[model samples]
Target: MAVVVGSYSFLFVSTFVAALTYITYQLLSSYLHKWFAMKPVPGPEGTYLFLGDALMFKPKAGEFFRQIVEFTQEFRDLPLFKIWVGPVPFVALFHAETVEKILSNPVHLDKSFAYKFLHPWLGTGLLTSTGQKWRQRRKILTPTFHFSILTDFLLVMNEQAEILVEKLEKKAGKGSFNCFSDVTLCALDIICETAMGKKIHAQSDSESEYVKSVYRMSDIVSLRQRRPWFWPDFIYYYFGQGKEHDSTLKVLHSFTQKVIQERSESMSYGETGSDTNQGQKKRQAFLDMLLKTTDEDGNRLSHQDIQEEVDTFMFEGHDTTAAAMN
Candidate 1:
């Protein structure tokens, strides 16, 4: 019995070593192929072999985004340039013709590899989905964003904008202030209300757990994207900010799920009741439209589907719109 156990252990060890070696070889070969293929693309000089341009990426929160914009401007004359983030290659397109070529082709519709970091929080929502799923989802959601349908949410946007103006007015004549956070919070309020039909009041109550989780999650995801070592789930969770990431994700997903459940229940009740409230000019939210939306086969979106789209909107809408507004 002892001999048999020892033999089994030896075999397991040998097999594990062999498997690891094969995987390493395959990955290295793939990276080499990609590197050779992109050799024609111009890049910054003096990039490290293993680290690539990763060391140049600032570790601070917003610096990564700023540096990327700076790099693009620095190489604006080039049609496209390549940057190595560890083994991964990032090709930046500066020419309008090059970008137009990619966008005009349906074959190039898949999102970038960096978007994978958002899968934990967003699932396979419209932002991350590819192939047929993306086409189907886009078809179902196109009507929701139509001019007529979008007009319903104007009230929420205007209300949130007024609140933002009021807050900024108070700070007026006091001193120069960074209004980024204030503007982002107002955008958050508009997005939450229009997307979920739930008032989170982010401007008035930024300390709320849900609000904090949203910001924390964004920071954590951004950090992971810049740090190649954190690409692996095991490394990220055990060695990095795994616990905080998970806890923040729980808070975000919990809030979204709870809101979805409440909205679904209320929608059912509304369908059965009299159309009294329907007579009033009540603002219809994206969630309300999603509940009624159907696919080409007349199939309703699943609960998870609704949640993913809501979460996608919540993430995509606020900060981007705020950035533009600021």
Candidate 2:
């Protein structure tokens, strides 16, 4: 019994070490290859061998952004500049021509590596899918955004916009302040209503578990994106920010899944009450339209598929629109 236990322990340690060594070698090799390929690119000098520019980055949001701005200004003359965040290489394009070259290329449709951090929260929805999956999803989702359908969303947009204006008007005569959060919550409310047929009223109640989970999950994903050491699933989930991430993810997924289940059941029973009023058509949310959509093969999307798209819309629409507005 003692010999068997010792053998198992030795085997476990051996396997662990082998995995660690393999990972280290792969990272080192990738760094060396990128270092050589991008050697001509101008970047900050005197970076550490392994740590690179990561040590210079601040954990604070404003400070981190300031550092990035400084870097861009320093390398403004160059079309592009490279930086190493640990073993990962990042190349920032400064010129429109340089950016257009990549953006116009069909081969460059795949999202960057950082988007993988969003997979836990969003799955491979339209925002993150690539290759044939992306094409298929785009086709499946294109009709959902038809002008008529978007017109229905106008009701939601107009209502949320009024609420936002009222909230801002309350602070109009007061001292100067940031309106970003207020705008973001308004956007969240609009997206929630338009996407899921549910009213989270994020502008009114931002303390709700779903609302808080959305922001917390974004923070966790952003932090992991910045830290290369936390890229591995085992390291991230077991060692760094794992418990908080899991809890936040559970809240988000549960809310989305519950809504999806309810919407599906509602559609199955033909319980839509659009015609109950006098000449006022009920606005179908994105979830409502998705429930009735079938793919090219006449097969309906599975529950998981619908959830992915709904969550993707929620993730993609809210923050970006808020940022643009603010």
Candidate 3:
């Protein structure tokens, strides 16, 4: 009986070891092949089997975006180069021709895998959505931004610009207190009024929870992008950055959801069998337009869809205006 038990345990242990060895060998072999393939591209030679160029990435959140630009400068002679972060390959093209060749193709319209990082906050909105869903949403929303619609927004722009100038006037001689901040606040105010028809007064209330959460979320995203170790959702969450991220998302999404809920309650214009605003000639808010709008197939956006687009608009517009100002 003792001999029988020993033989059974030995067989089980051997089988497990053999399976593990085979799997490890297969993974290493595939990685070696991929590494060899990337060698043809002009990039840092003799890349490590695992870490790749991840160790070279800037540790600071602000400089995370500059890594690609620095690579371009360092490898100026190469029109195209590969940046390996861990086992992932980031192929960068410098020449306009190479970029246009890929970008100009409709089949390559899908956002890269990295954009999935934004999915938790942005959802499948236009900024991150792909395939048929993106096609349908884009078709529906594109007309909303026509020249005529833009012309209508000029009034909101002028109003916000005036407020921005006034704010700057107060700090005219304060000795360089980050004027970039003034621009961001003004941009936030403009987006809120123009898009949601609500005045968040972000210029004055910079310390608001929603505002802080937005900035925090932005920082967390940059940190996650550069640190490949944080790329896996399971590991990220296990370490609690994911929880922190979710907390920020909750704050940000609450604001958007509140805006959506209020907009829905106030107007029945887009919804079937709902009363329209008392026939007033008020300028349309972007949210109002989207609320009462439909696609070519008579499909109105779902509640979640509206929230995603609104949040995306807020995120995209706020950061862009700040970057431009700086």
Candidate 4:
């Protein structure tokens, strides 16, 4: 009787395992193979079930981006191509017409679903925002970037540029050191000053906690985006990526909150809700402008709203631009 019971249990477990495997394969293959057949543009062939090309980064983040670049060049003749980011298909276009068509369409203004991950970091600011709120926010923030305002920011830009050059001069002919790191620091410093009317001195203090967290958070977010298994919040939070993300958010948000509070307190003393320093006329920073400005309905933004925009611009302004320059 005991021998018979053991055999039955073994059979049941094996059957269950086989069924689960078969089901997963069928679901993965159905979409992948079907999409492969349907796509006009070429893409990675016979991808792994849920991983797509994500596994190619194994052993390390590896040369995954180089592989994509090579793939793009390999199919240079094609106007566009598809790439599966963990079963999610993205169409990459190289042709001017194809890019223009997508960009010019008002209907396609919605951000990609991947941007959902940014909600904790950026909130629903301009980059991730859409529909009515987006329209209203865009209207209010549009003039903040006007030519005259940007002209004021040029001095900040030049000052940061000079500091970068000074740093680079010391490294001249001192063997091969990473130039990307220095340039990124310079960009961060410039954006901090211009965006918040605060100087982070990131270039001088490269090991600052806030600066280090920014770089780490960038890596963490990129890694999370590439892996589909990490997409579900329950799984991500269970495995502790969520905690790391939250910790990084504290670093980023606290810094921005401090900047906003410092500026807010300064503005509180002024009847016009603006600040003056050392008896000299001070130019309004981005946060100051946002605080004084209102939406289409003439409603002043709440502290939460201002924080969202401040965090969004800080991330977009510094991180994206720095990475691009590097």
Candidate 5:
């Protein structure tokens, strides 16, 4: 009886293990086959659900962008091509008309939900904002970037550029150096001085905590956008129970708050010399425009709003130029 009982137990365990394996295989196979079965609009055919291609798509970094350009060229005649970034669906367009339609109707399509990762940093500012709030903010800020205003800011830009050149000449006496790093520092300094009215010598002090934090956060935010599943509100808000995200937020907030505080103090002291109408006309920087503007209810901007905008510009102005330089 003991021998029979032991044999029965072993048989039962084996049966259970086999059943579990079958179920797992079926589930994985079903999903994988479904993903594999997606039709690629025909032009230049390539592997659709291959593991290599899926791995290539996830980070969507420089290499992924290059892959996209190459894929577009190979599939130029295809209307819509499907690529899998892991299990996620990535639809690509190779036609001008379809791309134009999407761009023209931003209200209908809107930014991808993946962009929610930016909410912690940008806080619905122009770059990350959508729908009616975006429309209104765009209208208000459009004039600030107008050709006339940009032309005026050239003087400020040239002054900053001169300082950057002076620093580079000092460093590159006769040895070859990395132009990429040098230009990025130059751009950062110019944007900080011109955008926030703060002189951050990013060229001389590459180790500045604020500057380093900005770069780190920018790269992380871009990574987060590519992985939508990881950006649920609760997880990002809690930062998965770690202090890294919290510490980065503190650094960013401190830097922005300092800029706003100094600007507010300067305005209060009447250092702008804009007491008279004519004096006000002479001042045309972003800060001056922000101070003069009012919200929808004719109420002025709150300190928080001003800080958000300042942070938005600082991140956008520098990172964009840096990417372009690279």
Candidate 6:
């Protein structure tokens, strides 16, 4: 009875809200058309809404960025032009100098609210952290990815690459296969091995549930960013809306916790051993660096901090590499 009542209430509220939005949109469009003086330039004719781009910006997944670049080129004749993705407004700059100025003025423009969608997964890690925290974390973590350290990681990368090549060889004479899935899996393996120092075979068909969860969580987060109907944090946490996101997070946390716990246990048992020295001296992965690091007060990072950073690396490293490969 409660479920039915709640469902009806939600339906009623959603319908009312949508009706109001339609009315407001019509009014706003009419007002802009009449009152605003648009300096016309050569481009496609239309206006866009702030959040309506998801509805009209139809480009293949991972190809939306390329489409934007193409659109910009097509309008290169104009110094500045407007394009609408639904009712949202976007001004494209054709001049290199203008873009350079915007890029250089880092302090003037803040990261877009779209970034907040990643906050739950990444926390205030280097990728999402700003100002001093970002600087300090970056400074501390930079050496971990240095050329020397990356050289050590190459063996892991090559091993994973070999696995992928073997898999592809099996399908060599086959008609066709999804190259995207293959690349995505390979990238996940690389990220897991390098970042966490764990040899997770996410490239395999029978990949860990944790690895699959990361991909699912990423998709949910990306969807929320593109079509933000409600506050994402609230929707993700409170509304039980993003069940996949929640489940993925739990699995990811469990995996990270297990890693940290095992590492901690090893450290505890070997009070003075080669394993401890090796962890201390040579080839520091991201997690190794995090384990060694201490905060301003000489306190170790909380478990939450380590988990967030590890998760961030997994998401950022895998997706960006996959997209680049594609």
Candidate of highest TM-score:
1
TM-score of 1: 0.91
* Comparison by lDDT, 2 against 3, better one: 2
Candidate 1 C-alpha lDDT tens digits along 1-326: 99999999999999999999999999889888988898888887767766778878888777877877888888888888888887788998868899998888889878888899999999999999999999999989988898986776776788889999999999999999999999999999989988888889899999999999999999999888878888889988889998899999999999999988877898888842111244666666888889888888998999899999999999998978989988
lDDT of each: 0.87, 0.85, 0.81, 0.81, 0.69, 0.70
TM-score per prediction, in order, is: 0.91, 0.88, 0.83, 0.83, 0.71, 0.72
Model 2 regions more than 4 Å off: 1-27, 61-63, 273-279
Best by lDDT: 1
TM-score head-to-head 2 vs 5, winner: 2
Please write out the lDDT profile of model 2 over residues 1-326, one tens digit for every residue.
Answer: 99999999999999999999999999888879887887787888867776777777777665676788888899888888888887677899868999999988889878989898888788999999899989988998898889988887787788889999999999998999899899999999999988888999898999999989888887788777777778888998788998899889999999999998888888889854222237877778888888888988999999888888999999889988987998
Provide the lowest-lDDT 10-residue window in model 5.
273-282
lDDT of 5 by residue, 121-161 (tens): 77878777778878878877777788876776666568767
Q: List RMSD in Å for every model shown.
A: 2.8, 3.4, 4.2, 6.1, 8.3, 7.9
- CA lDDT, candidate 4, residue 117: 83
Considering lDDT, where higher is better, how would the candidates rank from best to worst? Answer: 1, 2, 3, 4, 6, 5
Q: List ranges where model 1 is wrong by over 4 Å.
A: 1-16, 271-279
Worst lDDT 10-window in candidate 6: 270-279
- For candidate 3, write residues 197-271 as lDDT tens digits: 777878889998887888889888767765778898899999849999999999999988998888887786543
Q: If both were scored by TM-score, which would come out higher, candidate 4 or candidate 5? A: 4
Candidate 4, residues 30-51: lDDT per residue as tens digits? 8778566746667767667556
Q: Which stretches of candidate 3 lie over 4 Å from their true place?
A: 1-30, 44-47, 172-178, 269-280
Candidate 5 lands at a TM-score of 0.71
Worst 10 residues of 4 by lDDT: 271-280
